[model samples]
Target: MTWNYAYSQDLWPAMISVASTIFLGFYSWNRRNVPGAKAFAIGCLFAMLWAIGTSLEIAAMDFSTKIYWMKFHALWQIPTVTALSCFFIEYAGLGRFLTRRNLVLLSIPALLVFSLMVTNNYHQLIWTSFELEEYVVAKYGIGTWVSIGYANLLGLVNLFALLRLAIRSSRSRWPVAIMLFGQISGRFMYVIDSLYNHIFSPGESVLVVIGLSCSLYAFALFHFRVLDPILLARTIVIEQMSDGMLVLDMQGHIVDINPAATEIFNRPASSLCGRAIVEMMPSDSGIEVQPGKIELTKFEINLGLGDAARYYSLGLTHLLDKSGEALGYLLLLHNTTEQRRSHELLLDKQRVVATLQERERLARELHDSIGQVLGYISMQAQTAQNWAVAGNTGKTVPILSRLSEVAQEAHADVRESIFSLRAGMESEWSFLHALRKYLDHYHTSFDIDTELLLPEELSEDILNPDVGIQVMRVIQEALTNARKHGGAHKVKVVFVEEDGYVIISISDDGIGFNQADLILEVGKHFGLTFMRERMTQIGGSVIIESQPGSGTTVVLDVPIGT
Candidate 1:
């Protein structure tokens, strides 16, 4: 009910527009983890504030009914321009690959233009405000579109940059492109119309809203993949590979074995518990068990391998401990199926080479040991046997005072034979055979059946060195505790799938104690405490359930990120 030109009807839209923009700004600020989310959101903050500031002039005019054009709403154009400019840069990816020099050069345009617009707004540059007949009209200056032709020009540059980034990233750009199309095209049209007259003054905010929602939709679609990118990629490659791949831990237990590996070994991963590498390969080149970043020779098995006649060039690398011991080996096998013909000829050549090596080892052994021992037999026959066991029998010259060599020839022959056997076996059998043998010994010694469950798909996720060792540790601790504390008849361990987690359970019908009571008393054994700590260190939680005379159940649930 105010007088003419006093209360502008457009004030309501101004408030609502700015308030919505500010809300978006605050929402994006809180979600800082999202990439590029801050850019548009931050720009919206300034845009909203400036929008409110611009509308305040309407209130001032309502109070004073001022005819002064430069009094109130006019000053707001500066901040609005500044906010939108920055927003455009981020949404368009204009700053992504921008050099420092390029940015510095770009800043110069704003300095020269912003001041010019503020001082002479009604005449030149992006827009010019002219007076129409009465009603205090502001007409468009020449080439003035959306009150800022220069602003739109800069915006186009930003949009093009964003388009390029979306295209070049080799990523899904459908969602982003949809968002940009809605935002940039809508804004472009508005800017073009504004140059002619007051055609599309403020309706472009609707398209801006659409753009934000599309971006959020895109983020939701892509978030889970970011957590475990390699797992998804592994699934794609598992079936495609031709060569066999087997992964194992330090204890020679199966971590993950591919379809080809299972076919070659005639066993699934679960059945090959603690199996030694020697049992499968049983070749001279398979004994190197050191972990971390090693290139080992391919294991050759000659039960007359038909199609697998070619040598496999194996690359073995180890993860290490801080004390510099091998933690585990990463095994990669390159199939050299095309080289078996060449290899047969090479093997013939290798036999000749080995004959030379054998002569040298014997000569060195005699020169370094047996011949010396025979000479020293008169001096120290009793002492030579003791010296050989000490691994330094050849370190000293024949002793002069107490020549006590005991059965020196026999002792030297035994030592030489043992060394040769170890060297031969080290190259012959792999860890798989050893692991299976160890598990067999455990079953025989403890009279407990150990069960292993494996997944159908052998994956890099399951084969990771840290993860495999942790699983083994969990199993080891659970078994040790069951044997020590749980006075039960039968021990059962079941691995099941639950809520994207690999669930493990160890339980026995032992004399159970109240877990809650024992924890409260602090007087019980530290075994449970140690187990709990180990589980906690690996980002997994352990639950213990027990009662007086009932069996105890220990559950460890681990996430595999598959």
Candidate 2:
């Protein structure tokens, strides 16, 4: 029995008290710079005093020493409760209540208790009677009960303050509530211990409660960031963000749209918040997403109407709850209209520079080829005239033949120049109409029966300018090949759309060359090669079918709007 008593007195309460003191002291130090730190630290100091005084009282062998430390333990009780109450008030954002007049009023009870505890020798106010039990003195008095009731009242007020703060905060409230519950449970057990007089053990069970409460406080501080406003202020930052934001519920209906989103959509927030996302998206933007699916990749879309068309890059994210269940979706839109405009302007400048360079090249070619050919023709005509004056008839005849040959060569050079210029410039409706007329004239000049077929819906807008130019070149080349190489002379030109493609087929009933002969004589089909290359460059294809006796057909397939 003596060994059990020593172990209970020296080991149990000492171990629990020391552990609680170390942890609470460390917690107080860590948050020394936080708001309400001074009040919280004062509470910690009182708690440490309670723990150490209890341990020293347990270790004291004499009744006098035990009684002396008992008073010391009681000395810290009022201060601890008072300081914790102050901490709770500050934590609840009610610091204004801690005025000089209110604080002095609050301090009266603690000061009276301290004076009574120190002057207890003169009168047995705090301890009316005492007796030694289990090598420790246990005291009883009405004053002790009064102090206990008073401390408990202060604790209840602090707990209520914590609950109020938890309910009012916009951030997560569960952590604070959990801490408050822990304190409540600890205080309930302490009341039971004080009433029953060590139903478990003398002051040992209360120390365990204190340790548990301290753990709860630390949990709330670290996990919930109880003293910081980082999570609480997120709503303010999001409200003022520059990029547009829209939040959608699981049904894909817009639930919230911020001011920036309203500005970007050019609509008031009232109009956008309750509408469906599909109804709000611009026509022809081609945005497709499945409901509830997480889409992290962003896409670009052209929005707005006509001349005010603006571009936006959009991203979607899934919003999740604490349990990781998908709640809804968040859409973010960033305006990229200005950047896209600058890019297109840069492309336009490059095209203009390219056109100027091509014009300079044409001028140099005219000077080198046509100009020299005309000069040669003038010299030959002069020579022929001089020979005629000299009466050299034979020499003049041969010179005349040479002059005729030079003139024909110059005519071919002029025709080639005209064709080259037309290929570069034929992009609009006027060019297409003029080309159809030219085709009619060419067939008449060549004495070939020709038929032209065009679709009723064919328009210049359906074709890109660069692709149209290449298409014209390819058609002109095909016609030249059919008229020059083929003997039979019935031709047909057809323009039609099929399977998202614009097909131009030129067919001729003529003596066609063998496909096998193309390998042996590649140079003989240079026109076909050039036609295939031009179509391929513009994301199109060409197919040629020809045989010895059968007709020849060249089909050019270009993607619509390519």
Give the distance in Å from residue 92's predicted Cα in candidate 2 to where it truly belongs: 2.5
Give me the candidate number with maximum TM-score: 2
TM-score, model 1 to reference = 0.37
Tens digits of per-residue lDDT, candidate 1, 1-562, equal 2334445655666566666666666765665344444545655655555455445534443333422322233333334444444544544445464456765665565555545556554556533444433223355444334335556676566567557645433232554465456556645554554444434333223223323433443353245232123533463355346666666677554555555566556676456535766456655655554442333454543333675454555655565779998766555555565576677789689668655754665575465456666666645645655666677745434542244343543473444334433322343443223223433543564666655444455333442333444454455556556654665555666667667677778777778877677758773444556566556656777888888788788888777652
Worst 10 residues of 2 by lDDT: 1-10
Give lDDT tens digits, candidate 2, residues 317-367. Answer: 889999999998998888888888898899799679757755675576566
What is the lDDT of every predicted structure here? 0.52, 0.73
**TM-scores, all models, native as reference:** 0.37, 0.45
For lDDT, the strongest prediction is 2
